[model samples]
Target: MSKATTSKARILAAATAIAVEHGPKQLTLDNVAKKCGLSKGGLMHHFSSKEALLKSMTENMLHKLEEHGELLKTRHSDALTITNVIRTKKFINEIIGMNEAKILLVAAIENRELLSSVKAAMLEQKEAIMSEPKSEMATLLMLAADGLAFQELLGISPFDENERNQIGDKLIDMAIALEGDLHE
Candidate 1:
């Protein structure tokens, strides 16, 4: 990787951990720089401001989501199945727990305006889901994914991995049945 990219990754990693562990209020330039082994100037070189850092973190999640969507299209030959959606949802849940999602929440509290772009992208994704033939069911499935992810994020999710997988399978079965009816 290029030097700038490498540096940015390390910096963001440190920042994310700080935000999650100590709260976003503690994610200061000095803290990030110290944690990531960069000077304040170095961190600032990549992200000029705290808002810029937050924006990059938000962009990172959106980029990954977009990339995952492309992979879904390619894997299913441009047909994103309910099965694929459920699987992706599972993966997304993991990401939300482990990564920039904490920072996104921080950003929400720190600056709501930083999320306008994410809002637009998510609306586009929602529109795509809504455009499916089994619109209501598909929307429900999508919303369920969000619900599942949020519950986990909030430490309130009750399902173990096995249970979660079972639930996914059930969702896929129901979705496929709805889709089949749409075709009939």
Candidate 2:
């Protein structure tokens, strides 16, 4: 990648880390600059304002997921819609850290345009998967999964490792059951 691309990537990565550790309310240009080892002037050259930076971060995340959507089209044989959503959540939890995700999610929601895009994607994905059968159940499954993640991220009844595992297993079971009902 070019130096500009690398620097932009660094800013996004650093912002994510800071947002995860602190809240989005705490995100600042100085903190992001220090984290990425860029001078304030350098950072400012790339992102002139915090709003711009947040917007870029949101787009960066969506672009990354779009890449995953492409990968899923090639790699998965069946149920790519639901599977990809589940896998994407898992990827976020593993790679981005849930706390960071929570902060980013909240921040993104505060941006009207960004929130609309997010909501549209959620609706589109759920509708696609629910088209199979037991559509309501599939929708419920999706909502429940999101709820668990958000709860964990927000420290609202945060789950222990075992609890997280158990919840995941239960979600899988729910998916399987829905599949059976749809096929029947």
Candidate 3:
């Protein structure tokens, strides 16, 4: 990547780490700069303010999700179907392990306006899923994924690794059955 692109990415990554580690209220340009080993002036060159940084992070999260959705289209041939949603391994990993969701949650609480684009993107995805032939199944699969994500984000998930895997396998089986029914 270009130097500017690398710098911007490092800034965003540092900002996200700060948000996840210290909470959004503690995230500041100075902290991000210190974490990124950049001077505050350099950080400002990439992100003028904390809000700008958070906004960019949120946009990056949305872009990554869209990319994953496209990959699902190639893998499953029906991106909006329950099968594709259930088989979202990359998204599942991100939802469970990455700080992007936590950053967005903190940003939304701190400044609702920052999430307007995120909300719009989510609404667009929902509309597409609602138009699918197996809309109910798609909704169910999405809800299950969201529930797991929320539980993980809040550190309240009760499932151990084996249990979580069992649950995921069961859901995949259900999705496969749904796909079969659709084909028939």
Candidate 4:
């Protein structure tokens, strides 16, 4: 990566750590700069304000999932609906058992406006699934994934790790099976 990319990543990493450890209220450019060993000016060079930083953090999560979605799209060719399921699975994986993800989620919840990118991504996935013949099944899968995220995001997980994994695997299997139905 270029220097700026590396520096911005470092800044984000430090910011997340601070937020996770001390809460979002404790996150600040000066604090992040100190944590990342960058000057305040250097940090500002990437993120001008807290809103910009929060926006980047939320988009970063979606970008990782989208990157995987791109590869899936190339392989499956016509499995657009299944891609949404896979993206949901990836998103759930990103948040489950991840401190940084948990923190970022909480931060996003606190700043609802920062969640627009995530909402947009969800809308896109919903649109794709709704266009499918087996849309109800696909919608159910998406809802399951969203419910899983909320369970973790709210610290109200009702299932053990094994059970949750089983559910996730089953949902992906169901989504994959829908591919043949789409062409029928």
Highest TM-score scorer = 3
**Candidate order by lDDT, highest to lowest?**
3, 1, 4, 2
Provide the TM-score for each candidate, comma-separated: 0.86, 0.82, 0.88, 0.84
lDDT of 1 by residue, 1-184 (tens): 9999999989888888898889878989899999999899989999999999989988887787777756765665323355466656666655464455666688898899999988997687677767767777788887887677676565577987677767766776776677668658
Residue 111 lDDT (model 1): 96
- In candidate 3, what are the lDDT values of residues 68-100, reduced to their tens digit? 867877866643456666566435564546567
Model 4 quality (TM-score): 0.84
Q: What is the C-alpha RMSD of each candidate to the true structure, in Å?
A: 2.4, 2.7, 2.2, 2.6
* TM-score rank order: 3, 1, 4, 2
Q: Candidate 1: global Cα-lDDT?
A: 0.76
Number of clashing residue pairs, candidate 2:
1
Which candidate would rank higher by TM-score, 1 or 3?
Answer: 3
On TM-score, the stronger of 2 and 3 is 3
lDDT of 4 by residue, 1-184 (tens): 9999998888888887887788777888889989999888888889998888888877876776677666656655556575455654554474545564665565565688888887888798889888878888778878887787668656689987778777777777777778767677
lDDT of each: 0.76, 0.72, 0.77, 0.74
List runs of model 2 lying over 4 Å from the truth. Answer: 69-76, 105-112
lDDT of 2 by residue, 1-184 (tens): 9999999999988988888777777688999999999999999999998878887877676677677667755765445356556656665565655654554564665565655555677778877986766667767777888888878777775688578757866776667665556556
TM-score between model 1 and native:
0.86
Show the colliding residue pairs in model 4: none
Clash count, predicted structure 4? 0
Give the runs in model 4 whose Cα sits over 4 Å from its true position.
74-80, 87-97
